[model samples]
Target: MRNLFPQRVLILFITVNTIFSLSGCVSHSKDNNDLLCVEKNVLNTANAEGSDALVLKNFEARPANGLLKEISVDLPAYESVVYFSTDHRDKILDAANRIFPWAAKDLQTIISKGFKPDPKAAEPSRNGLYVLFKLPNNEFLLLQGIASPDAMSHFTINDNGSLKIKLVTFGTETVSGDIPLVAYAKSDNLYDVFENAWKNAINTEALAGRTAMRHEKEYPEMFTYLGWCSWEQYRRKITSDLMVDAMQKIEESPLPVRWVLVDDGHQHQTGFKMGDSRMLSFDAHPETFPNGFKPLMDLRSEKIKWMGIWHAMNGQWQGLHPDHELRELDPHLIKIDKKFRGEPLPVMMPKGDSISSWMFYKGLIGSTKKHGFDFVKIDNQNRQMRFYKGKENPVKTVSQHAQSLERAAHELSGGLINCFCSDLLSLMNTKYSAVSRVSVDYLLNNMEKAKSHLFQSYQNTLWMGQAVWPDHDMFHSSDKFAGRMMAVSKAMSGAPIYLSDAPDHFLEELVTPLCYSDGKLLRPLAPAVPLPESAMISALTTPEAYRVVAPLPNGAAAFVAYNLAHPTPQQIVKTQISTQDYQHAGSFIQPAVPKWKVPEEGLVYYDWYDGKGGLLNDQYKIELDGFSDCFVQLSPVKKGWSVVGCIDKYLAAAAIDAIEYNQSELKLTMIEPGTLVVYNKKPVKCAMASKVEELGGGLWKIYFPKGKEKVDVTVTL
Candidate 1:
């Protein structure tokens, strides 16, 4: 790699209380006004040969005025793509952000002269938690904020073509001493760059007490089975009678719904508006749920495995009500110096101390478990920073609250779904929770909204998948506009698959492709992520289909392409898929030898939606209409044979629980019964298959009896 650093460097110090700028090389200065100095020692470095090496230049700043507000860094502007948050909403929960490409020539102009806001603007700029730069030379750099005990950090583009790191603290709380404003890493791989930077950022002495949960931790059991949620079905108007009727319909329907989520409306709260309401008590609302969940809990059986309830992370949107019963447990009323709807706003929060916070969440979750709930979905977690902004230390307050909530939820219930918690501080404090909502609520009818939802869910998974199991939110299977698209997206997500359809409103055909009749989903080995070739391509601006892939069991891969053009593209968009897109599909598969060993015959390609089959040596072209999708499977051909898996399911290969290849026979174990398709150059015999048909060109169709689970069939070639 060409060295970008100089042998001898001269650092200039600037003394400014609010903002400081650095440009070009300058001689070393020793003036009294120069209170800020740059440390010459390199903290961390990654050395790789050729263009793959990502160098970290030595540059550490010591604040001039006891507290540092902002620092700017200048670097060579190249052709790059920037991924940043567009608003204040949590990146994962709200799904409101944009990724754009910048030409090498236009980078300087765009950075120096920021765009002017227009009332009719399609995309707006806002402060971002982290900014990722995809350099043209196959290298990536990620600059992210590290949450400290007293302050949080964000990034902005300065007018002088520099990247600025700004720190936010609780009211009057200063970030003094040697504080690392921003943590960064450079790598050829996107995942490596992000993980390295995030690890370096959070593993500091300042954030020593807080621990982040690993992505490989065991997620909630409900994620493996099909589920139903009450949010989109009944919204805030859900009642006990409605829930009972819904459950009765679910039990009778062919769609196997195992877990039930009792969403927001069941809680007792006080206020005129839903968004401004504060929770009143832990008990269910008397008017809505007269018996307080006993009738609902009675419906649980072998078929209905688990039940979960929803609550805000801070009790409710506006926090606890003035006369809430839990107030006696030592609640802290934080008065905001700001106004909401032209009125003074005050929020009641749990005490920041570990003991008090633990008691606060314990009271809420303990009562929930007592009422027969199996888990809790904590929403509005990102609002903790806003509620306690001026009251307590940002990191300490968020860590304590998150720990208390997760601890209580795990101990009392079995699991917790971290919801509306996409902020850095909240994400860092996620010590035990394994499941998190990765996108906004799935809406109905609107095709644009559906496309946006899919785009957000898939794109957010690029980073959010590193923290927790992504929950794409619930959808309605009965919607005529976007039902199939949503269903296919969920199947490809490798996350939990749930629906919010009203009673007797589901389409069995769409649901069957995702899970078995027993409610067990055929999930991929890992979460689906964007193909490396399509990583920087934005569907909003470009007329291209967004491609995502996930690893399936037994060395197979599932790839799905979505046409997410907004306002709907007029003409069909043609996209090409090749073996390159499916390379990472088997990265998560165990017994890794099956995936790494390339067969002499190459891989077999099967189209799930179109029902086509062939060798995957050449590129496959797909034409997608507006808001449509294309699903395909690629499995390696071994010993002149290939198992196409169960062709009935969307992610067909995931249905194979186990596969063993011997000298002349292949033993296959399946999770569900379906049409098993295999490719063999020689004749094959299978006794378990009721009938076998030879479709020309070495493709054979074997039929397995319906209603059989764990079907084992040996095919002798």
Candidate 2:
């Protein structure tokens, strides 16, 4: 075995003792002013490395805690941690995140300098569980737990300001063995350390691009889809008539909505209320949909193109009604719930016997398809990981069972499952789930809730977008107060823009941000995200930054900024436009709507709401009204051309849509009537356009009529 430090390292003092009778031995010592500890019998077997000085803490079990062992290590000043949890409740190796609160500068520096670990240096524990800490001094501290059949792990800070890693039992099992916990030190970065641990456990690199591509291949259609859901407006009171009315409204509107999702209220029973509560029969509620979900499904397919419905992952209230079709189809499908009192719980057995796992999922998903549903929103899935008990070998582990269930859902549903209210860890196993909710619900009642949605939308997209398309929930234009902010943020975030409003009250302004003039869905070039500072501050305190920006394929940058202070009565938020406001942008240009034109030297900024803008320098500032937000488009200015109107320079340069421009005569198309600005060095005569006026300073202003798809301007110099 390799010594953690060189033999020249001198030891100061050593203490050794045995705490638990069945557990292994524990020893602590000071060598070269470093704290060290050795734990024996962490696993069923002994450590191959007999002695290592750098091992900080090794524990079989703490007698004071009764089979629970804990260890704390100090973090270098200003250095944060990245904590990886095993599963939400029962899944394994599924979710990961950079933990603790991180400042903007720190996060930016670390994420920019990616780390690569040496594959051969990995040393994972038996169950392949380990924790890696990146220190400020450019070193890594690794904690490897004794491998067990299955375990759940997390980290917290102790009172003494030290990071602690804890492992506890989950699910219905309390089985325990030699609980081994070992620690190691390395002069490497956290990313490398994580890669080493992952290589040791699963023998693979945690390549971001590769993982993203895998999910993309698994869920092709969900990556970019336009849909409308019922939760934001109707909540749990959704009915067939409401759904049909919403579909009819969408069909009439210019919005390119494709999916009609039924959230929460369609089922016979949902939630945890038991006894008289109906079982999750996977059947529509008779009162709400007397004709069942088929009528709505048919209407959606004919009018909207696709259909989807929602259900709790554990069925109704973590138990199946004894009279449910699943139980009738297979006797062993639902195990009797002896874990509870009063009513005998009929727990869903998603894994185990062939009839319980395969046949149950097959019949359940097959019924939904036969009912005309094409997609499903699986919600409250974390409960499945926490409560499920397996009955067979090979699938004994929670991760195995979860994977099996997810696969069954994918295969039966034809790979169109949207996961909601699921823990981050279990989501990893849902390679088949097309869309995943990254944060909590998008509550639109107050400014605080609006801020939360904007904050989480950016943070979650940054951390989890690579794994799956982050679902930002639904937005509302008819909410009266928070509608504008909701519309702007959702449209810019590159997330699915689903609106839930009364059919007659649908606001056209809300749809402007989501679609182009021609009514095609406006897909963002990339997922919008906030800066590092925003994420760090949001974790500990109220996040002041509420912005999501993405680059367009037309070299224009689209951004949505929310003045969270807007909800306060009489509050005017003054925000400055700095160079950092759009570091990767060329010039701001609206992707969906035509806006103000920028001058030659300074850029022009246009607000989506009023289509207003003027020339501004780097230090310009703007004020916003209470509870309102703005969407802006930045288009890069070409070398020798100055634009005057709301013409899309990128589109004009590429002749996209109806925009076309050439050398002498600049020919363009306008979806909306707007003034155009043209800058030339010499005096030019303009003709053929609707109206032409000189704005002096070699800038010419031209006007085009609305609905004019073709316009020609002859320029003579």
Candidate 3:
């Protein structure tokens, strides 16, 4: 494609999935014919095209005489349709890359009068329909969009000046909906410009309780649960027997799980067939669940709050399910030219009735509900935006399909949806699923990737978290190097906790306490906040630290820090640790000894690792290794006396789990048949049912039978 303004050719380039690591050059070109370039890295690189690829011209632009009900346009993957008139083109460019709600910056604040990079440079001129900012390394940042009161354009801009935008409309368009234009900015690093845009957005949209309102409405439970998914372990090979066995094992463990996830295997289409679309028919795989999903449904208990299954957005790889019941309802729903899995599947038409789309979704989601599934992890959801063309109806954009499916999931299944691979713009404000995967899939044990993942999770928390709880995907239970690192990151993410390890690989000692234990969810005091860049050492030197400062439901405030650093990258290889080794790995790493100035008033900082801490000093330091963490749960210091440490014999529970206290009483919950220790400052009176021993001036030993629910301890000042 050739650019309409300068007539430059557009070329498409594909880079890594999440990170951009390419060898390219930034040439300073004065000639308009020359294209300056920098390496572009993006998560969805497959669909991205470079400036050399194609030039898009004005498609159409018209004003609706009346309020349009809704406008839905379907385009190819990564392709977007924008409607614009000659006058509105500049207005759209000024609003490029503004993420809704959180980051909306006005053009007046963004631009200055007669702004030019260099005094000697050519006077700023708009020869074409829009202006482009020349960037560093001879690149340009293009900012352009479609703007009508109801017709808003959503955009995703890359650090390399590559931008993707989709025009959203509430009503039919009277103008041509195809004004493809690129806006520009001059910069050394386009990524930095994007960050500035986000900051500017925050300044404009920082309304008190806005985030809180979202949390309460979209994620009331703040869903923290011990979940098991079938992806990492079983893949498409999961069976009824295997899940049943896993459920039995989960029940037997001291850890409590509220949801059991049936990841990616139960669907019926593309069976055992490589080179076929990974999409599956919504029906359960006959061989895997011969008797239907009733067997799995029967396994739910009070602790097992929901059983979730995975399915694609439009059935299989953006095609309709051949076996879907709605196929007979409307022949117009199916695109005759598309044989997704050897059959023409239905597509959500733009001009179709809401009832038709609702009924279509009802059939798919209803099928799972019939089999006793309560939650649905909607995968390949990005396909909902893929351009759709029906045989008899107008083209439907993914935006319309997304809204239709969301409503259907809400109406049919009570809005219990976990959106994966879906656009953030669609989910936000619509109050989509409580849980959403924000970052790309992380490595099982690669600490480097884990670091990047942690940074991205925190980034998502800061920017997109208000939309939904950001999920960091799954972490294995046996990855000694980075498993716990990822787990801590997940907990800090305020998202759900799910393990993909097999039944035998369940590392109770390490994994159970992260999400839940004894029916109590162990969430961070607040969402994990990334430390400022100044406070952080490079990933090459030390693990990055994220601070979670929140007062527990109990009286104590939590000052916890998680380390997401590891030694190597290849550690993410598929490997499993033996049950015996997992139970004993804690023996090798000594408890962290931390020193730091406490944050709260009248409170003393006590390290929870091995339970040894004291009064806050000027500096706080800890002996931490890679993938390890230290928490300083702030306790009130009455008469200079405080409980500094606690430990569980089996390592099944966290140090915080060793002591549960209110104003006057402390209850120690036991997870294993072993001894417990409470390192405290003052004397403590124990109940008759417990055995207490004085180890030293401040350490107290409290012994309780294995699996005991609670043991009381009274403190004497």
Candidate 4:
């Protein structure tokens, strides 16, 4: 592989998700011993760092403050001895690539290094490294990564202008759980933009990078501030009858129950239920489901779509249920690497127990068709990171996971698999469960908490075959507000949502959806239009409209005007009623009336709606004793998307229409500077709600209004 920048080594990565990258370096004036690594898409400076010797050193001090300090690499698989530094993160990477084009699968830099020229490129196999080749003329073409680590990195970027770079492996959690330090440029205002950059880095490093070797993953995005509960709570009360009952509920839940996570109870041999004694059976714990497995039967009838069995694959930490036949059966199965921290012990990838054991697990799958058991949840596990005994390839653990499911899939066409994890990353798609939890905990209130939970859920959902559906670990919110928040989450996301509450904590209304049904599910109307009115406006207006129309008090003006056309695109037209048309502004109504002067600046502080659930706000300066008729031109935010409603009978009836944008009258569209909404296009289909229902309690149900159907309403602008 030819060196694009022989002297440049340091590359930048977006974050924990994105992989480490390398790039050409730019020379900055060297100042003191304080050093920082910086590189970009283009090569601005050059140097000669001979590649004869290999340097390996780790920094004991924290990274330089206020400067870019990177510590990771982006290549999928390559030879490595880990060390991190601020000054050399960039230069060292460049030097390494020059000497080791075949070093990191050429992934550290999206350039195919060491490939044969011309006709040789046509050969079937590659080194399993991908690069986006943009020719000298700026022509772009997609190229895949090498197939294997042994393959040469042969690719090119002949373009002079098109910019490309690799990932950085900074800010990652080390095998020892230490967060490797990262330093950015002096102007590092690390927030959302910075966070996104890092996520992209590790993702490419781990996923796109070519290598069968797997690495542990991090999911700070989805799991931040999440709500989590210990399985012990349920274990405390597990009874054979209750276990059976819990399974039955699984049968009746809606939406496939995304994840019927089995918590800790099973391992304790904690047979609070009669099923306890049957632990040795390694078969269906029939006592747990006394009614002949009614729960599984119900799911088979379509209540729980995805079913699973939970296990503590690794944490054999507890000295309980010791089975002597374990090590004798398969030495590789029970023994763990000694290098692992703490008391050395084996960790289960697929499972450590007989129930989780390959043979036992395989048999259980076949026997449970009458009471669906399509998933498996293994908890208390981590990736193989430490130097340990009984060590195995990171791929092997995934291999076992795959073998576990592959055995099951042979019997069933498709299977639903998930696990209990705080970031179940590093597992291969084919080898790992279909879904896994990402957070160590879960919570509420902080808006980002809710939004990100869904975001994490969506990210995993988008995986083509659902390799990993993120688990926003479920919990029951005792508060109704929290419940509403959950509904909002369920409605506004793409993840397979689940909840874990003592069924009693859930309100009947909320649980109604998860209740047993005839398998026919009801889907709801989606893509709800955002209201045109501002939240501030919605708080001030009467029940006349979902939107609010208020006047900004301006002198000599009867009232200020406002329109709530925020959610969609529409041209709003209104027939105005003037002062001569209607007079006598309401005044002196209060027991203690206060005089409101015609202020030069039409802003008067009126205390209203305080007792009611509304915020009173309006600033207008005007004289109300006048007469005239006016109309508001309601239309889409875009000049091309707005239209005036056709005033069909002139003054007889009002109407709304989709054809609202006016091309020529862009000037009049904004009555004042900053008047036009710079945010969402305020389009709304306004008419009236014809029917409403009030339950015996305080709940009110409102339905959309239907105007003249099939008839077009021309909006008069």
* lDDT by residue (tens digit), candidate 3, 518-576: 44445543344333221122232233454434334223444445554344332321211
* Prediction-by-prediction clash tally: 0, 20, 39, 105
The superposed Cα distance between candidate 4 and the true structure at residue 672, in angstroms, equals 41
lDDT (0 to 1) per candidate: 0.67, 0.47, 0.44, 0.27
TM-score, candidate number 1: 0.86
**Considering every candidate listed, which one attains the maximal lDDT?**
1
Off by over 4 Å in 4: 1-233, 246-263, 267-281, 284-307, 314-332, 336-371, 383-420, 423-434, 442-469, 477-481, 490-493, 509-717
Evaluation by TM-score, superior candidate among 1 and 3: 1
Lowest summed lDDT window (length 10), candidate 3: 584-593
CA lDDT, candidate 4, residue 66:
12
**Residue 670 lDDT (model 4):** 14
* Model 1 per-residue lDDT tens digits across residues 279-348: 7888999998999999999888788889989988877777776667765664444433434688865556
Best by TM-score: 1
lDDT of 2: 0.47
